[model samples]
Target: MRLLHTMLRVGDLDRSIAFYTDILGMKLLRRQDYPEGRFTLAFVGYQPESEGAVLELTHNWDTASYELGNGYGHIALGVPDAYAACEAIRAAGGKVVREAGPMKHGTTVIAFVDDPDGYKIELIQRD
Candidate 1:
């Protein structure tokens, strides 16, 4: 079976949406509010859900933050140029946690950025 989507609990739905859509250049594929659950889910991605995996941003109406315990790692995205992507993300008001460069003990170029909820996103240069 194919992978589906990764869910991230965000404190502010609008802020998270802007970070994924505006800062990361992803599209808001679909979104729905669960009134009974007091939560909302928004899916964002580079392509349609039928074509590729996407990110699901879930916002609980009463929760304003998450601890993001140490057990969690970062999400990775393939890019044409890690350096250029970092630059663009920085210019767009995104926080670049690490600058683009050769990875430690390896040659693959990579960089890291943080989302509104302090989740790390790794950008790896593929080609």
Candidate 2:
């Protein structure tokens, strides 16, 4: 079976959406509000959800922040050029926690950017 989506709890839905769509060049696949649960879910991805796995951003009406415990690792995205991708992300007002370069102990180039909710997203250069 194929993977569906990865869920992340975001404090600011609009900001998070902007980071993913505007900065990361992803599209908002779907969005829905749960009035009864006082929360909202927005799915986004590089392609149609039917064909690609997506990210689900969950915004709880009451939560303004999260701890981002150690249990969660960063999400990875394949890029034609990690350096170019990182530069674009920076130009788009995205913060690059790590500059694009050859990975430690390896040759694969990589970079990192953080989401509004503090989730780490890794950009890996594809050969």
Weakest 10 consecutive residues, lDDT, candidate 1?
101-110
Worst 10 residues of 2 by lDDT: 109-118
Across 1-127, the per-residue lDDT of candidate 1 in tens digits comes to 9989999999999999999999999999999999999999999999999999999999999999999999999999999999999999999999999999999999999999999999999999998
Clashing pairs in 1: none
User: Against the true structure, whose lDDT is highest?
Assistant: 1
- What is the TM-score of candidate 1? 0.98
Tens digit of per-residue lDDT, candidate 2, span 1-127: 9998999999999999999999999999889999999999999999988897999999999999899998999999999999899889999999999999998999989999999888999999997
Positional deviation of residue 39's Cα in model 1 after best superposition, in angstroms: 0.2
Model 1 lDDT at residue 35? 100
Question: Can you tell me which runs of candidate 2 are displaced by over 4 Å?
Answer: none
Q: Roughly what TM-score does model 2 have, to 2 decimal places?
A: 0.98
